[model samples]
Target: MSDDPNRIKALGGGSLLIAWQLKDKNVLIVGGGEVASQRVESILTADAHITVLAPASGLHPRTKLFIELRGDRVTHRDRQFEGPSELDGMDMILTALDDNELSNAIVKMSRERRIPVNAADIPDLCDFYFGAQIRDGPLQIMISTNGNGPRMASIIKKRLQAGLSGLEGQAITKVGLLRNKLKQRAPGVGGLLGRERMKWMSQLCNQWEMEDFSSLDDSAMENVLDKGWERGKRVPKPSELGISRRSTTSKSFSTTSLLLPSIAFFTGAVTATLLLSYSGRR
Candidate 1:
């Protein structure tokens, strides 16, 4: 909380604004190099339809969308950025171009059109900042120093990536199993009821270790749900889920607390049994 007016708030430092859920939405990227590719890969997990604007668009085999390679500076190619009309109607915009002017122009245009933009290396012109991430299956770990220190974010991300090595996918799968059990038990709780059930299920997941997946079974799920029901009437808020979406989208799980230990377990030293198994194979 500096009054210098030059500091952008880092992620997880008291108050932070984060947005998720860009699935099936249009995401425009104004560059096609490695930096831009990193941003594209980050959003691809959310199922966003990406449109890349570059002089020479490279192949993104995993991207199920269009890539237009204009000449230098985004000339005219198959479905190139025609104009604001092309840039308009996008859910989000990211600029990783080498030219500061182009990036600034894109940011300004996006702002005029009420679109959010994340400009690499330019925080003043950006509406948001991308963080370092660790992914295991559907589980995602995001660490941001806001725009304060990109190096710090990268360091933390690398540490987490090492610590949460294998457990990312396992933790997500375990939670899914628990959530499904809750959903089945309370099929009629559409709005508040269904969400509360999910909330309690998350609590259960937090209370138990990932290795003890048995603790997240049907009986445990029901017990957690019943306890929540006993608490009386309540409406859930967006902050509860860390990142909330519209009704059409599933609520994002707040893995901030849950992902740490799981990452450590997955990436840390293996257990004696695991070591024995590896030795035997060797």
Candidate 2:
């Protein structure tokens, strides 16, 4: 295990990103403020049927799909939301209420009902954390800090926005091109090799400094895949792809090498002390 404290702490944290398929699924949003407006767009990205519960009805353009329920009185009975029992079958729930107590209560209820929930700005009450996401054709880039600091996540996402502008469509097209070529080269074995190659190319593409993604050439991509495959076969997980066992062993040896000099100095000091004591006694 790595000695990084953030990595350990973030293990228990919610997913930094999610690819949800909410098409034809019911989704409920508790508040109709700007936050709710933003969440509505995200859910609608999956083509979900959404319902909003708020006192008055005013909506952003993106929230047009959802049906709105109005009223100030708490009409909920039987511990069930009165507006729609349809919401009970919803695969996901999002709450953006100003009332902390109400948000907390709804989050607790959602958990008991086994529905995934996201309470805006409240990581402790949420089952998932939504990150800054940018959609480019078939590729989706998600940047997150596990809710430790959303601002930092957003900043990184913006930086990525400029870096990854036209890369996604290009990458997907390249993958398709690569796969088709592989079908002729190795047939059944092509898919496995194609996937490994695709992964390497994607990583290299992401590291590009400029919006000009002309650097994703086939030869270079293949070299990375070949190296990655050799390295990957010896590792247990994909995250450890670039890490080398030899480098780690070398660092450990260096640490041990430093201690030898200290040990020799300490031994010399002790011997000198012993000689001085014997001469004084004589």
Candidate 3:
């Protein structure tokens, strides 16, 4: 958490970043305005069972669309949220009402019930902030200034998006497939502990070019992975691979490291072009 006043005001101080698994959990949402609608979009991706309590008259268009699209996954209660009783059996609660008093009341009730609550635009009242994110298939990068600078986070996300290429996503998928296969082939293995496994995977990534993997057909890809697995099995210890135990435990490869140099060059080009244009205007 950042101590910057703006970030603290946006996200609150002492907030820990975490990914919640909301699949099939009941989430209670109070209000049906645009803010609530935005919350709905965020949670819906997690497959949470949602109940929105808001008057039937003033539902935001996006909220209405969510109800329509989600159908049985979402239930709409055509009434105002009265009190804490609504928090019963909910895994999480979100309040997006225009009334600060009502939002504060709900937050207090949620506290008493021990349910996590997020009050839209009220960092002090929220348990967590919806930080900016960039998704590349199964790989996701989340940026937060502890709620201080969301606009800055968004700008960074765009820069990263421009810098990264789709090849990295394919590489992640390939790596995941290889890991699963290795785990299945050598279950409860001694040599392939966390650190050793990471070392082997890192070496595999270093040895195999992304272009080579991309050019391969499904069968060829499997052959390449199988050959890598065989080589990994032969190196029973990290020492055999010339990687000391300390080195293996100290460092880990990041998937983002797979981004091609060409992609980075392009990103730099784009940034330079923008700077040059601004300088000309000045």
User: In angstroms, how far off is 251's CA in candidate 1?
Assistant: 32
Query: Tens digit of lDDT per residue, candidate 1, span 1-282?
Result: 566544654433542646588877888887666777677677767777777776554524322232333122222223334567767678898888778987887787898889888888887887777787777776677787756787898988877665542644765676687567656766775698777776666665565445344224456444444544345523223233232222211112345457777977776656766888999999
Task: Provide the overall lDDT of each model, using Cα atoms, as 2-decimal numbers.
Answer: 0.63, 0.62, 0.75
What's the residue-level lDDT of 112 in candidate 2?
Answer: 81
TM-score each candidate.
0.59, 0.53, 0.71
TM-score of predicted structure 1: 0.59
Mark the 10 consecutive residues where model 2 has the least summed lDDT: 70-79
- After superposing candidate 3 on the true structure, give the runs of residues whose Cα lies further than 4 Å from its correct spot: 1-14, 189-198, 206-218, 231-282
Q: For candidate 2, lDDT tens digit of each residue in 188-269?
A: 5537666765565456445532222323467644443445444652212323333222223345577799999999999999
**Pairs with backbone N, CA or C atoms under 3 Å apart (clashes), candidate 3:** 6-148, 7-148, 11-147
Roughly what TM-score does model 3 have, to 2 decimal places?
0.71
- Cα deviation of 74, candidate 3, in Å: 1.8
User: Across residues 4-114, which tens digit of lDDT does each residue of candidate 3 receive?
Assistant: 898767863445778899999999999998988888887887789999999979899999999998887899999988767888899999999898999999999988888
Q: In model 2, where do residues sit more than 4 Å from their true spots?
A: 1-18, 55-86, 177-282
Q: Which candidate do you rate higher for lDDT, 1 or 3?
A: 3
